[model samples]
Target: MEASPILIAIDFGTAFSSYCISVNSGHDTSKKTERYETETVILFNENQEFEKFGVEALTAYTKMTSSEASRYYFFQNFKMELYNQKITENLMISTMDSKQLPALKVFSESLRYLKDHALKALSETVAESLVLPQDVTWVLTVPAIWDNAAKDFMRQAAQKAGLIQDILSENLILALEPEAASVWCKQLPTSGFIEEQAGILDKSTVQQQAGVQYVVVDCGGGTVDITVHEVLDDGSLKELQKASGGGWGGFSVDSKFTAFLRQIFGPVLWEIYKNEHPAELQKMMHTFSIQKCTEKEDIYIECPHNLAKLAAKNKDISSYFSQLEGACWTDGNIKISYEKLASFFTESIKNILEKIKEILDTPEISIDFILLVGGYASSSLLREAVKREFGSRYKILCPYESQLAVAKGAVIFGTDSKIIHSRVSALTYGINMSRKYDPLLHDPKKRRVNKAGDYTYCTGLFLNLVSKGQSVEHDEDAQYTFFPVDDDQTEAGFRFFSTEKLNAIYIDEPGLKEIGSFVLPMPDIRLGTNREIHLKIKFGLTEIKANAIDTSSGEVQKIKLKFMSE
Candidate 1:
């Protein structure tokens, strides 16, 4: 391997995962392989230790007998559990069998498996030299809509996996999944994308031109993350609006399919079968998953032998399915009508299209292109839905191998972090503080008196640092000055709050939420109330960073906000 730094990007998606390796600036093409991604599935032994990952795990579990499989744990689609939820260091996640295990253990062990696999691949590619952990820069992809707590949880998981020694090490970078996709899409010409308009002659990177704007709709397996970007004058990218999305993704369609099966098999029998024959259920879903992504025509899924045996106890299996709509039983396979199959994607496609319209509806924001990326973007059903709704107004483009875009672009972002110049603030951030009570502006009920009874202060005041919808650059920071309310106070606590409101007034407002907090030590009380503490908060990156300096002792304290614990 070359002495130059090597970059490895890991796209840990909900349904599937993939990684890419690059030496210096280009890919390390020492070996040729057709597979670009694998199932995000893991299997653990009876002792709760990691056994297999990805395809191997799926295969091992599928081969095991029902009795033998019950002793072990199989987990898939576990990544989505961290989204839109309160995360803690000791959070526990349940396996498909409803077995409990630490979330940290599951995530860290999975990451460790990927790390070792990548290193092994690199070693075989270059026998002349060995690659060390320090020689490679790691990039992890995460959804842009994830909160600070979720992002922090991923960093801690990476550290626990031995990817880096320190939590704040520069060697590990968290690349927003949509942003990574944007970076890779910008380097391609119009012809590189799928379903381009007819007779388009300009072949250069049309979206790369200065002032060109586009919307990145990352329809992953778990969630769809949408963001608007514009090319800066210098060719870098800038976010036009904050990322907005929902739980609408490819998995939603899968859920509908599961429901449809339940309808055919009767809810009581289906529930009982799910509890008794989980392995068979998993196998059936796995088959449906592959067919849903492809197969535009009628789809046939083989019914598990156990499920068929159980259904026969009540009545003829063929007679049972005949009563169902758009389903037929023939040759031991259940055939699904194409119209009924397309209906599975109705909710996801509707939500995605509506979100894109909402973002483009912003005043002064004219989008020239719409880019679809991620694993779900490969679905022919979703492609047609997006094109039908906005194809006439904007150039809808999906790059070749759209699923690999995030992983490959993450490698490029790891090499150069300045490709994204700015980002839009998703929420208003501020610190909860108390100031001198103002009779005119402060509510009398909120007024408080100190122990000394000499000063009157108002509690629950929200000191705004950054407002929602504000454009912030990576280097730009919001600074504020604070002082102790009591002359003899030896420490101060900083509480961080966020809300969707553009300008919040109080910390206890209806929509505001206290995310994390940390206490800063003020060992020196000699300066009394005159001591000045400077707090600086930096945003626009994958995670928020905060630090404070005490002018009296010239001490700098790095802040890692603590979230709610279990």
Candidate 2:
């Protein structure tokens, strides 16, 4: 008999990355089964060579020689590049030493490291004979707000890293981070008001059985994704509102802290400290990261003797630090007050609260509870702020081990994907086609004579398949039939576009963006432009898929749409 399938989840994050594995077994009842055996991926290298990953990477970087450290490339928060709308195919990652490396290569290497680590972990946990890549299913968690191009980029990187043979295959699944966390939270035990409410609500009565509605606030290191869902009687979840978020995350707070540091130290001195003492800078940032998650009233960061020495060399830096408020250097350590630290979180926290308020204000959604999960969600400061703002209106619940929710939930998702019954499309999707010219609607400049001498408009009209904010069921496919525009055309091309407006009339309209294109070979087009091709575009899945059928010859073809960078 074949061994039970193993589910491995990779939560590739901005400030950090982690992976988890779970055995597919219905009999496991341990409380920890739903949680991920997480491992952080932090790469460290000396002499510009790839060395180690995870905790080992941190240890190696700490012990490396200063000369060696200066030559090393320590990449952190590189995942933010994918979220950048301005990213291009030629984008390259810049190292601390001003060295440049291909972004794709860095991402692929990180995935490769995670894959190997998961394999090693499975081999140690399970019988050696039963451990094999083919027996394992991989689930990758991505932010829901990411564009199709970013998602496709990650898929391609995973393929290059050997994480999956083919991304489109069932062996590799993509789970949206927010949705995955929601699934995991639904399975976990709740407490306080939410638990009491669940008990009081009748589970059997149809009259009181609309199920509880909740909003998931997934606050990660890079982004915060919020979505509303309503649990059904059958325990499945239906998305009641579209997923939305911004780049206001924990890293943004860190950015503010860095700015504070710049304010104390002159820009020239700060730059020198970063370049000359990369290892110390990394250690300081790591310390700050740990402290930010705690409730400490004051954080005492070790002032690297070298940084102080560098500062001493500049009289302006010394003068600036001497006059800095809420911070003081003593015993070679800088003590920053909680008030100062909390100020760093103010902007990011405000942005998050505004987004949640915006979602709640929607006339269609009525949330009874709020579920907070993700790395940033674990911050006590953030939790208290959210509660103080919206606690009265909704029961706020943050589960144990919330930071690992997305990865662990990804494992659960790999085991059973039907937990989420539906999703709301974030954008309106459609195809571009030419329609008959109308004097009242079409611009005269767009009018042209067809091959059959018929007057037609060549306007880039949008043929909508899915509308923004529309709820779409899983595995839903939208089908359309179109004929070739020209006789003897060797191939037919289809352009897919997405827009925020539901009634977008043209592809070039504002807020309309071209996502990708599909092309179908029409070798049998001797039948002329009258031959029709039936195209089916699948939505409500992790990624969109298209299938085209040549109606004339009954030949079916799968078109792989390539999402281009805007």
Say which candidate scores most in lDDT: 1
TM-score, candidate number 1: 0.93
TM-scores, one per candidate: 0.93, 0.90
Candidate 2 residue lDDT tens string, 1-566: 12236777888877667676776544132432333333343454544456776667777776666677787777777787788575555568866556667777778888888888778767766545546666777888999989888888888888888877765656778899998888777766434122234543334321134577888999998999888889887877888877889898898998988788877886888888888877777778888888877585899888776778887776533465577888887677788899889989999999999999988898876787788888898788898899999987887788776777788777777777777888888888999888778888876776776666744656688899999888888768898988876777777788988887986887888888787787778888678888998999878877788889988777787766677563
Put down candidate 1 lDDT per residue, 25-89, tens digits, no spaces: 65322333212478998899999989999999998888887788888888888999899988888
| The 10-residue segment with the lowest total lDDT in model 1 | 27-36
Give the Cα lDDT of each candidate.
0.85, 0.76
Pairs in clash, predicted candidate 2: none
User: What is the alpha-carbon lDDT for the whole of candidate 1?
Assistant: 0.85
How does residue 314 of candidate 1 score in lDDT?
A: 96
